[model samples]
Target: MTTPTLGEFGRIARFFKPLAAGFPGARGLRDDAAVFGVPDGRELVVTTDAMVAGVHFFPDDAPADIAAKLMRSNLSDLAAMGAEPLAYTLVTALPRGLDESWLEGFAAGLGEEQRQFGIALAGGDSVSTSGPITLSVTAFGLVPTGRALPRWGGQPGDRVFVTGSIGDAALGLEVAYGRLDIPAQDTRAHLLRRMRRPDPRMGVGPRLIGLASGAMDVSDGLVADLGHLCEESGCAALLHADAVPLSEAARGAIDGDPVRLALAITGGDDYELLFTAPPSASDALATLAADCGVAITEIGELRPGTPGEVVVLDGAGAPLALVRRGWDHF
Candidate 1:
């Protein structure tokens, strides 16, 4: 069956314009650029992320899931900096012969997430790509002046904490690739969902303003991202391998396999917040976790050592050597 195609202007009028209806700054998608204002005592936070069809996701993955993942991943960046989402601009480079239904599904997914996250589509460009479906979003958010979180704020003796379970996304990627065998249908579904649509810690980020010392979302491996924080903060981290939280599905998938456990620790795309806080903030952190309804687990601590060094100790309290720490796009 041949798929229908619309001209550029027709596509914008029919599909993309509605996404800008709620945001006055979008100018109803009629103007060449978007215009908006940031509140008087707040700073604007902007982040951009791009996803390729074969690189970031399977080429045949559902369009809706792809759209959701792209938007949420950028939102995770904003959350890492303790910002509240406001608006976003999207760029779509789609193949010439793609089906129109794919655009419909993609727009629907973005609309749903925009409503869920209280953000609106501002403005952007779309073009035909000779290669594959490539999408990028430049998300804008707001934070109080001088209150945005930094990667260099961690101090020695500060407790390292992570929001939500770790390694589920990596395991889910394995499930998606058919590399891991799991007999349970529910378990497979859980991991796959975690990979496809990450739950960004939106609620926890804004509240972390006065609490967390340093923070970054776990996009790369946990150990690698912690190393980045340590490098910025001029300290080293001692991570307790046993304390890193794992979902029941992830545990069952590992099944006491040390190799799989290491993959879980080093594999990237978890998107959970890895942060540090002083011991004095423990009670406040516990209360914030309960109020936010998210699991915040203490996995390690910063210490005086070589910067950017991350030491992962096993349950026996000995360092465990690994082949690689995280993903590298280079």
Candidate 2:
């Protein structure tokens, strides 16, 4: 016998409404739109990111992880703007025959992140789709007036910094694809986690207000994203290959293989923040990293030259040729 299906309203009332609990602005997901007053002395920052099954994530991946990734991806944008997350709206398009259990897990994931990041689900829409699962999150954050980091403020001689080690997510995708043979289980597990879960540098971004001249999250590969910053700021960049921080797991994967190193450089999906600051603020940034309990590394510098030019130099001062910069939507 065919089973009954949970319609849109029923699904929202059963799974999503609880996720919006305690947020008066959400109006229990009953209102047409959420309403909230911005706190005094702060401005709102909004960003949206979308994830699709088989493109952004594996089709069989955990519902919760997929939900978390979508939320974190949007949150990373807010972090790049030096804002703290306040609230978010989620919209999900589910494939035909989607199980109620899947919705439960997805909502649970959103609920968990809401509590962890001190945000709430204001409202959202859920609909069934004939194609793959698609989820979008529009996150809201707040920053002090005129303190949000500017994407176009990077200047020549500004030191480039990145939060946490790089390239783990790229290698993590390799692990997910079963292409890499990592003998160490710990290393494999680490890479897998990096691919499945991304950490948005929310704590560090706030401390960078008025300190960083420019900032953005590294959604694309490092080289490609930095090139974007340069193009926007009308500057070039000279990146030291040796200084690009790598996790122990990534190092192991790249050991003795220069191609693997190149993958680390060009492979995308890292949600870490990439920001430019003056030399004088280096010490302050260091302190901020310490306080945030996340590693910050100096990888390159902006230079006065052709816009969109990104040069990667080896430790011996020789330029390294890269075939691809990072993931491109086109």
Candidate 3:
């Protein structure tokens, strides 16, 4: 006999309503839309991200992991803007007759991240799709008025810094694809975990308000995202390849191979915060990093030149060539 499946409204009531229990604005998922107010002296910050099954992840990947990654990716955007988590709305598009267990696991994952990040589900729509499973999250955050960070705030002569090590997620993707041969099980696990669930720098974002002149998360490859900052700020950048931090796993994966190193920088999905600060703020930034317990490394400098021109220098200070800088949706 076939197991009974929860219909649309039944699924929402069973799996999603509890996720909104903490937020009154959600109206227990009975309302047509969410109603909320921003706190006094704070402005709302909003960001949305969408993921497709095959393109973003393996269709058969764990439902819980998929939820965590989706939530954290949106939270990473909020963190880049120096915002604190508030609430979020979700949209799920699944094929007809999908297993109810998938929804159960997905909602469980969302519930776990909600508590961990101090956010709540507001309201959302669930629909049946003819194609692959698709998920979208629109997250809301709040920041002090006039204090949200900007991508165009970088100035020439500012020092560029990144929170946490880079390249692990990129290598993790290779591991997921069975393209990289890593014999060490622990190292392999670390890479795979980083790729699956990214650690958003929420703790560091708010503290970067006056410290970082320009800030953004590294969702795209580090080099490409830095170039985006340069374009927005109308400046150029000089990146020191040797200064880029790498985790033990990433280091082992690269194993002194320049091609792999290039892949690491360009493969994307790191989700770390990349920001620029004036040289004068160096000491304060150092203190902030120590306080937040997240490693912040100075990897490069902004300069006056053609906008968006990123010159990467190797350990020996020679220009390095890359076939491509980052992932392109187009």
Candidate 4:
């Protein structure tokens, strides 16, 4: 049967209601807003992220593509809190006409992500816009009351860790800008997919929340985002240049320029999680990696002096400095 033509309101309701059905404590989606009570000893960890067309993504990008990214980006914030994915609220502004094709695909994408991340869609707002489309997603998770990971938790000598690969987005953006080209292989398509849609480290969050002294997602490039972490944790970092995992694709694009490599490291939009942990929790990181089946690389450690210094070291542990600035919004 053909699906019903859900206007803005009907579309949002039909998409989210069934997903939150199993979440009894999520208030059944009947009221204006859902109610969530943090478990007796757990604290609510919530984060919101907004992505605007032309700024966050290309205006011509697919609705589902934007939907998937907004979901993952917001969930990554929850990951930073080391919280269990509980629920989320989405706000979207669509441009021009409401076409069935885009709405169906967009709803499917959000629903698929909610199921994948084990979060419910509680509520949100939507409107037609004369400007480009914009999506804002607010995600919430639960963490042990006093133990939710904070950006200020890092201590000197605590080793830093990053999950999954980096620079895919930087290079992906390069592809978008015609600065680089992919090999046109199945693997390259996969890399493009990674650049388009990233799987947030949901399970890894709660695992590292208490142990990770300071944590944040690598949305902006490594240099820029890690600088935020260091500033929050009140420490400096000596990034092992060789230790920074550059995809073979990214390595090829660098043309052997360490400066470009450094730029990729410092560039934003990677969306991977960057965290610092004490040496004592090293074994736990290993176990967590095994359980989650995702890479958790220990790249560097916090230093006492010089906050925002993400030193890139060569294979022999020599320092590599770049004249170029990483990603900057301004």
Candidate 5:
């Protein structure tokens, strides 16, 4: 028989079974519905994110990187909620002219991530699409009920925190689009890799368990993503522009003035976590960073809720305008 398009059960059984088996408590992918249970008194955290080629990934991306990033992007969502990964389900649409090689690379990448995180595939649907390939994955996790952080729990004085450097992906996109030519050696590799495979702050999630009042992953530009946090937390934010981390790679990619740099912040696809915790919990972050072995940066603080307003502050707390508005899915 010819290669078959994915039917409901067929595709789910094939892909999800393997993925589910990868996780410990993931019931066999053979039930009416996924029979899932969390630790008693612990709540479940679920998040979904979709990536479309030309929108999320370059049509010319290597299969392995695409698969890896796809999984990471979804997991990043759970990270924002301070959830430990349990399992996930993916629905992918493929373009025609499939090849075994591409599938192999894709599976290989997924397999690597599966091994890294104790998560398994659950189930999903797949089919041929008219244009670009798209992947939508829903990830599951367990968090203590009263401890899970969300995007709307911040108070006015909560200190804003971001994991790792920002704008690497934007710099990566510049290299991808031929806008910037990376010089040889280390910087080029750094920028390229940042665009391709982003490291999610997986370890930090547990530390944020009950500490952060509000949190989210920074898939959009930093400024834009920060705006989202403000909106969710029912507050406004004044960012110390000087404090916004900029990579040497990003700076080299974009010359003076953080205009182009700001673009990278709002351009999306960074996948870092942006969160808010009360100022009293400052030591918790430093200790958490040390305990989790990850770099955590404090960005800003939440103010009274005000929609449609974000001010980039100088070290002296003055306003600055930004070029890009960050990522939008519309």
Candidate 6:
């Protein structure tokens, strides 16, 4: 069966224009570029994330899930910086012979998430490509001046914490690739959902403005990303694997498999926030987590050691050697 595709102008007029309808600065997406005003006493926070088919996601993945994942990935960065989402510009390099229905589904997904996150589609460009379906989203957000969280600033003795459970996305990728075995249908669904539609920790980020010392979303494996934070702060980290929170499904999959346990720690795509704060903020963090209805776990602490070093230990306190740190795109 032949697929229906739209011309560049036709696609913009039919699909993209409606997304910009109510945003005045977007100029209805008719102009070549968008214009907007920054709020008083607030700083604009900008972030960009791109996902390529067959690299970040499977080519045969659902178009809606792909769109949602792309948006959340960009939003997670803003969340790490303690910002509230405002708008985004999208750019897509679509493959030839793509179905028009795919565009509809993708736009629908984007619209739904935009409404949920209180953001709008400002403007963007779409072009055809012979390669995979690649998507890049440049998201805009706002934070108070001089208050945005940095990747550094954590001191020795600060508590290292993470929001939500880890390893689900990595396991979800395993489930999607048919590399892992799961007999329960519900468990499979949970893992797949975590992979396709990760929550961006939007609510928790705003509340962390005066609390967290340093923060970054866990995109690369937890260990690798935390190592980045450590390097930026000129310190080291001691991560307790036993203290790393995991979804019930993740625990079930690992059971007693040492390899799966390692993957859970090092595998990436867990969009949860990895942050550090002083012990004085523990109660406040707990209160914030409760208010936001997100789980918060103290996995370890930043310490004085070789900068950029991340040491992971087992329950018995023995150092565990990790073969791979996390996902790296060359």
* Clash pairs (backbone) in predicted model 3: none
TM-score per prediction, in order, is 0.98, 0.97, 0.98, 0.90, 0.89, 0.98
Q: Rate the local accuracy (lDDT) of all candidates.
A: 0.93, 0.89, 0.93, 0.78, 0.77, 0.92
Ranking according to lDDT, highest score first: 3, 1, 6, 2, 4, 5
Relative to the unseen true structure, what is the C-alpha lDDT of residue 148 in candidate 3, on a scale of 0 to 100?
100
Candidate 5 achieves a global lDDT of 0.77
State how far residue 253 of model 4 sits from its true place (Å). 3.9
Candidate 6 stretches with Cα past 4 Å from truth are none
- Per-prediction tally of clashes: 0, 0, 0, 8, 7, 0
Clashing residue pairs in candidate 6 are none
Compared with the true structure, what per-residue lDDT tens digits does model 6 show for residues 224-246? 99999999999999999999999
- Reference-based lDDT, residue 62, model 5: 91
Clashes of 1: 0
Lowest lDDT sum, 10 consecutive residues, model 1, at 1-10
Model 3 misplaced stretches (Cα beyond 4 Å): none
Model 5 error, position 30 (Å): 4.6
Better of 2 and 3 by lDDT: 3
Model 4: CA > 4 A from native: 1-8, 13-16, 24-29, 252-260
Which segments of model 1 are wrong by more than 4 Å? none
